[model samples]
Target: MSKILDKLKVVELTTFVAAPTTGRMLADWGADVVKVEPLEGDFFRGYGKGLNVPADTGENPLFDMYNSGKKSLALNLKTEEGMAVLHDLLKDADVFITNNRTKALKKMGIDYDSLKQKHPRLIYATITGFGDKGPLADAPGFDTVAFWGSSGALVDLSIETGNSYPLNTPAAVGDVASGTNLFGAIMAALYARELNGKGDKVTVSLYGSAVWSMSFMNVIAQEKYGYKYPKKRYEVNPTAAPYRTKDNEWIMLTILDHDRYFPSLCEIIGRPELSRDPKFIDKIALLNMDNRKELMQILEDAFNKKDAHEWHLLLTQKDIVHDILKHFKDISTSEQAMANNYMSEFAFPNGQKAMLAKPSLQSDNLGEIENFRGPYLGEQSISVLDRLSYSKAKIEELLSKGIIKQ
Candidate 1:
């Protein structure tokens, strides 16, 4: 039998990363997701930062990841005729998602109040800059403000300090978090619908999601710690962080479980005497030594005695927390990811190979799928309209009037 979501339908009216990425995950789960786009299509079509693929003769890698396994229809919601098409589709849509501004949606009559009149059971989920009813609600949001700066995650890491090594986390921090918001809201709304016999409007914003994620830091700062990024964070954790081996290779060795592993670390480094030293004897005391120069200098010299690979094997056997600091290529070719089916080859529009996240499934229950890449602009407009029971003549008229793209 098909999975739980196989019989569901999702109407994705989103662009860019956050919202569309959530919709894509639903599509991968066997939902009949129809990606509604503007005439120009969703803006993420070229977000690959020059890593574009010419799929179906179109260059949109972001579109590929975010819209695969979904049908598409291009409609100009600003037009009366186009709104009619949306109304017709709403008659059967199980979930409707959009990332447009709240004011614009209300004006267009696509807001929850308006749509609920037509489809009372449709799950409505949305994303915004701040929120629909906050002072900063209308402020335009980008990934940077919402994810990096607002979250205070970057600030806590002390990334800006000149002495720190490579810092920034990958992109889509807020987007990823907000996507989680969308997914959770959808799940909860689905639950509510079963109980109340109606769907509800669920909303999340960049700022809200960022705030939710930074709760721990906020609590610590407000209560016990005067939270501030250290002037030189590496100066504090240098012994446990990456250091250049003799061959100029970076390696990280963390043996901070002082009472348990300090003796073993000392034996491994041939420094059996350091464990008995008063300066290094007290675990809590040394941690507050206020100066890690001695610790850093000793570890640096000890690590330099061997190359990264050699140290990796020796430390690993002793159960000492250590790593050679591998790169993305190392993980991509990793046997574990393949054995677990977390990553797999995807066929791009150009018939080239690409990496894509595997669909969620129990390993034994999964079956083959037609994993087509994303569509061109309005690629299935005519066919999609026909399926909606629109007459050919009326569809042509709407296209001619530019209410819907052909």
Candidate 2:
């Protein structure tokens, strides 16, 4: 059977991660995604440092990771001719996905209201920090500010605490979340349009998307606990926090199988007292303690007798739930990840053997796609213009006028 989005045509007009992410997902599923970039190209092209080689032209691993399986056409939207090219591209586009604001869009007549009039069946989707019409809408919707910090996630994760914690992973939380949710919205709208024979606008905000990802905590605080989480960091579960192993390595322990693992853990650690003491035994009572410091210290001391590897092995032998702190390299080389087909190796045009993490979904027939060395600035402009029925003469004229990047 054809892939899901075989008939879908996506005009991706936004830059950076979140917006491009939506288009990338669609393109992965076999949609005809045409990335409309600025003359300077997407800034993400410079996001990566030293390439596989010292002076490789395709140095942007970030760009390649996000924009694979899509064609790019560079155009200067500030130019009237470039804006004209956009409207032409929109003629039969099934969906328009963007993170750029309405004012910028209105100048190019790419606004939802404007496009909907021209092609009422076109699905218009947007991603922003706030709603398009809101006061904070104009704020740059970055993953750090909008997704993590503003969404109450940073505070919940306690990265906001003055007391030091490890730095966050270098991933775009908001962008990926926004992309995921926006993809869902676009697909749902497309499905709905089949029956209604009409398209609709789908909107997602960085702040709102971040909050939705935290629905579990929201429910627990509002309904179950009937109390607001403290503005300051509140330890949700004191016993489950990070602990140190005997060899001076950090291990996060959550003895939630307290009824089960508690006894085994005690036996392994030579701390039968903690297992036997009723005052410090049960979770609720332990939580209610006036002096948890003594108990915590005891547990920490007991844990420090062995290295992380020894503890991991000993705990697993007893069916305890625990894990080691895995770095990016660890996960990359992990046997489990390899077994699950999560990573694939490919040879780039430069003849470098690189490993790429697979997309969230998998298919037996889906093309194995690791060699897409992201486009040069407007690399496919002439080819893309040719598809739009522009003659070679016209394309050269446009390129020579500095109206589009090549």
Candidate 3:
């Protein structure tokens, strides 16, 4: 079957998670994405080494997850010949994606303004740590600092743990989210271009994405609002909290309508009488500090009497909105994930196999998206240059001069 983006050509000049993630998604949707790396390749190629995963075995799952289904063109952008090669590729390209800082992009003469003059129909998508006009625009930004730390997510989430030390965010969580947002913006630009025959420059920042992710809390967190952060578990609504089970596993409940579910929850926890008690009868009375504390204690004790799986079964039976917390290892083999094609196994060139996640979006037209390993450094350099109409002698000259790598 023809893929949704079969005819789209994307040139990706990026490293790390965010921009690469956008390129990966486009590739998954069937775009011919060419990843342009430096002669040393994307720095992320060595990321698996730091995690104790060997990179030499062609089994760098971390890199592959964000780079799969794309061709590689390792070039020396510092050289005029290499820059000429890149511009040639961009001449007929539909999109250009990058996460390089604006200063560096301008220095390399690939910034939006420079490219728009040449490739006016190209969709230029960029991801930054902060917005381009901010004081920190030129400053280095990573998911850890820009998304979680500066965006108030770190402090707000840490408050529930009852500690001054901030919690570390999971790896690339913000980058992936920001990348998804960039993908949406690129799709919108593509749609707009179809109507007006003009492309656009689209940008998404990690900090901005983080803030938008927390928009619900952000709006309520104003000084004029009664809501406040740093709330202890006991101080929160009992029906909407995490509880530890007898097996030491955690389960979270999300019963937004307390009045509707409080009685059922009380019955499930073997505290049916609490449903009748005026102090904890309704959501309003549960607002009382003492009443809330007592109910929390009762719920905690009740949850500890059953294993997480037992609670899961009970919650399913009662139709309560809840789920047992799962570790990363659990997700790989999750029945639901496997059933829904959220994860699948891929075999590396060396015959090593690993399960990897599919792109979040699913389409009936493009069922079961195929997974391919990421290209090696400059793996497609000759092929890409050949397709760009470079003569074999010129390609050899460029390679011999170290302007391109293979």
Candidate 4:
């Protein structure tokens, strides 16, 4: 079946995760996304090397995961000629995506104001470290600083102990989340354009996205509802925390409705007698701070008797809300991830098959996806320029002038 965005054309002038992720999602939905890069290619092309993937590796799966199924056009945007080429490409494009710093964008004459006036029908989307008008608007930030640190997520995630440091999350968690937010904004803007015959600018910041993700805690604190961040052992719902099993693996439970599930949970752990005890008999009794501490120790002692896999099976059978805390290695082969289309097998240029993360959406009518590896730098420059009606001699002249690459 035809993909959703088959008629759309996107010019992606983005680097790293946040904005590229939006472009990747659009490409997956059949948009003709042309990734514009500098002569050196996106900086992320070298990211996997820093992660210890060998330099000799034929393909960077990390880059491919976010950039596959897109064409590339390398240009020297620092030059006036190169900027002119970009304007030509954007003339008929449906969307322009970028995450460049605001000052640099204005200086380069490609900020939303500049482009929206020239291309009134173009959807101009931007991602930034902070909002455009903030004091830190021009500050450079990555997932670690903007999303986690500045968003106050680090404070909430930190342990209560004085010496404890803020917990570090998996890489690009915030960037990926922010990308999804931008994707939604772009789709909404597109719908609005459909109604009004005009496109609008869309902007999302990593800091704003991170703060939104942790809004629950912030709302509770702001409302003065007497909610306090809890230590692991003193969590409001002792049942909803991680416990180590006999095999040293951790299993987490999330039975929010303690009143409904406490009896079965007690029976599952071979502690049926505790279900009727005075301190643990009801949700109200267990909700008391002292009783919660007592129940936590009891559950810990019982959980330690069984391996995490055993609890996984037992909890599943009993319909308890729980999961084995998965290690990153487990993700590639996870049955659930595969079934949900969160990951899939793809072949690399070296003819080796590997699992890669997939776009979140899955539809039966997406049709047969093309087999594509990430583009080499400016790999499609000649073809893209040809589409713009450049003569072969002119294309060659531009290549010689260091204005374009193919």
Candidate 5:
């Protein structure tokens, strides 16, 4: 089957999650992606080791998640020969993706300005900790610091825990989100290039992406609106908070139209009289902080009388907007996720099986894309150099000089 980006060629110079995620998505969509790594390989290759997974086992799922379906060409960009080889690859490339810091990028002479002069039609896409310009532009940024901490997600989300300690974000959550955002920008740039015969630079920062993600809450958090973050559960809308059931399982309710569902909820919980009480009769009454707190306590007590499964059935019958909280492991067997091909099962070369997630976007023209393993260090070095019309002897010399690896 023909892929959406079959004609696109991408050269990725990245480490860790963010930039590689964009390349992986592009590759999954049928673009030819060449991942350029250093002679020592991308540091991310060893990330599995930190998690107690053997990196040499050819089943580094964490690394594979972002680097899969792309060719690897290990090159020492510090060397002139290596830089020349990279330029050769970029000469016909449609896109260049990177997560390297701005200072390092400039030192390597692969910064947007340098590459733009050489590859005018190339889409230069970059992901950073902060933005491309700022005092901290060259500072190291990871999702934990840039996305969660600096963007106020860490503190805001800690409200549920009373802010005794900041919550630790899941691995690469921010990076993945930022990378996905960059992918959309790249698509837009691609369309623009098609019309104007010129490529553009696209930049996405982890901090910026996190702030955008928090915009819904941030917009209403101004003093003028009398809103604040780190709000207590009782201070929030009672109908919208999570409650523990009799079985100790948690379920979240999203009853935005509180007045419409108040009566039904009251009856379902055997508190029908409460709905008629003047103190909790309507949404306007619930707006009073004391009334809201009292309602929250009442609902909490009611939910605690029923098991999660029982509540699920009751809520579904009434068409109430709610869902049981699920752990990450539960998603693998989720019927909806499986039916939509959101979760996929794959076997590594060593026969180890794992469930992986597919891209969220679906297409009528193309169905599911096939899953593939990521490349080993320099796995495609020889073939890529040969494709670039390098003489066999020249390739050998470069390899001997440690300029390239295979």
Candidate 6:
């Protein structure tokens, strides 16, 4: 089957997770994505080393996860020649995605307004730490600082976890979410372009994404009957929380239909009598903080009586909506992940195989996701320049002048 984005072309000037994530999704749909990086390479190409990843191979799996299958064009963007080369490349491209700050983008003359004037039909998507028009517009925003720290997600999450010390997020949650949003915006802009014969300036921010993710709680906290996030013991829906098992494994339940699921949950935990108890007779009664705390204690004690695996079987038999809190490695080995093509076996240059996630979307016409390795620095520099109609001698001269790298 032909790929959905086979006719599309993208120019990706991005680093780390967010913008690259958008490019990866485009590539997954078969867009010819050219990743423009500095001569030294994207900073993320060396980020894996900081995590103590073994240096035995040229592979940077972390980088590859979001960049695989994209062509690399390493050039010195600070140089006028390099900027001209980028302009040439963009003249015929369908999309341009970047995560550089407003000042950097303006300095490079690649801001949305500038690009839109130059190429009215080109989709220009920009990702920032904060929205582009704020006092902190040019501030450096990594996902950690902008998304978690500045967005109050760290504080809000710590409130639930009962940790006073700000907690670290799993990893790149904000960046990835922001990128996914950008992808949707770009798609929408593409659809609009089809009708209007002109593209759009799409922008998304890590702070904005983080806020959107937790807007419900924030909304409630500002309302008339405002309330802060409750502690686990005070959670109104006691069944919809995590409980520790005999094996010390945590199992999370999402029994959202409190009235219908509460009785069954109590029965499955061997505390059936609690279901008929007066204080816990209905969802309204359960909303009482004191009553909820007592019920949470009861559930916690009952959960501690069985191992997580044993509870999993019993819960499955009861048709309960619950899951064992698994580590990352456990998720990598999940049967559901494999069955749904959520993960694919990625073979690295070092002859090692690791299962990496396929792009998030799934479609019948989309073939099996390939595990193409990410390009080395400037891996396609010469070819890209050649395709842009640069002469061989000019390419050599540019390389010698440090304007481009291969």
Choose the strongest candidate by TM-score.
Answer: 3
Whole-model alpha-carbon lDDT for candidate 4:
0.86
The per-prediction CA RMSD against the true structure, in angstroms, equals 3.1, 3.3, 1.3, 1.9, 1.4, 1.8
Kindly report which residue stretches of model 4 are placed more than 4 angstroms away from their true locations once superposed: 54-57, 230-232, 367-371
Which ranges of candidate 6 are over 4 A from the true structure?
55-57, 159-163, 230-236
| Better model by TM-score: candidate 4 vs candidate 5 | 5
Off by over 4 Å in 2: 50-56, 159-171, 218-239, 289-291, 363-371
The 0-to-1 C-alpha lDDT of every candidate, in the order given, reads 0.74, 0.75, 0.90, 0.86, 0.89, 0.86
lDDT tens readout by residue for model 2, 208-275: 88778877777777755764554322234435656678777767777786777777777877777777
Q: How much does candidate 2 score in TM-score?
A: 0.87
Tens digit of per-residue lDDT, candidate 4, span 1-406: 5689999999999999989999988898899999999998898988989888622237678888888789999999999999989999999799999999989999999998887888999999999998888689899989899888876667665657757777776689889999889999999999999999998999999999988998887787664686676355566567788889999999999887776788889999888888788988777786688988899999989999999988998999878998889889899999998887788888877777778887775667785444357777898999999999999998999999999988
Find the 10 residues in a row with the least total lDDT in model 5: 156-165
lDDT of 1 at 119: 88
Residue pair clashes in candidate 1 = none
lDDT of prediction 3: 0.90
Clashing pairs in 2: 246-304
Better of 2 and 3 by TM-score: 3
Ten consecutive residues with minimal summed lDDT in candidate 6? 156-165
User: After aligning candidate 5 to the native by TM-score, how far in Å is the CA of 89 from where it should be?
Assistant: 0.7
Kindly list the per-residue Cα lDDT of model 1 for residues 85-134, writing each as its tens digit: 88888787889988888788889888888888778899999998788875
Error of 2 at 238 (Å): 4.7
In model 3, the runs with Cα more than 4 Å from the true position are 159-164
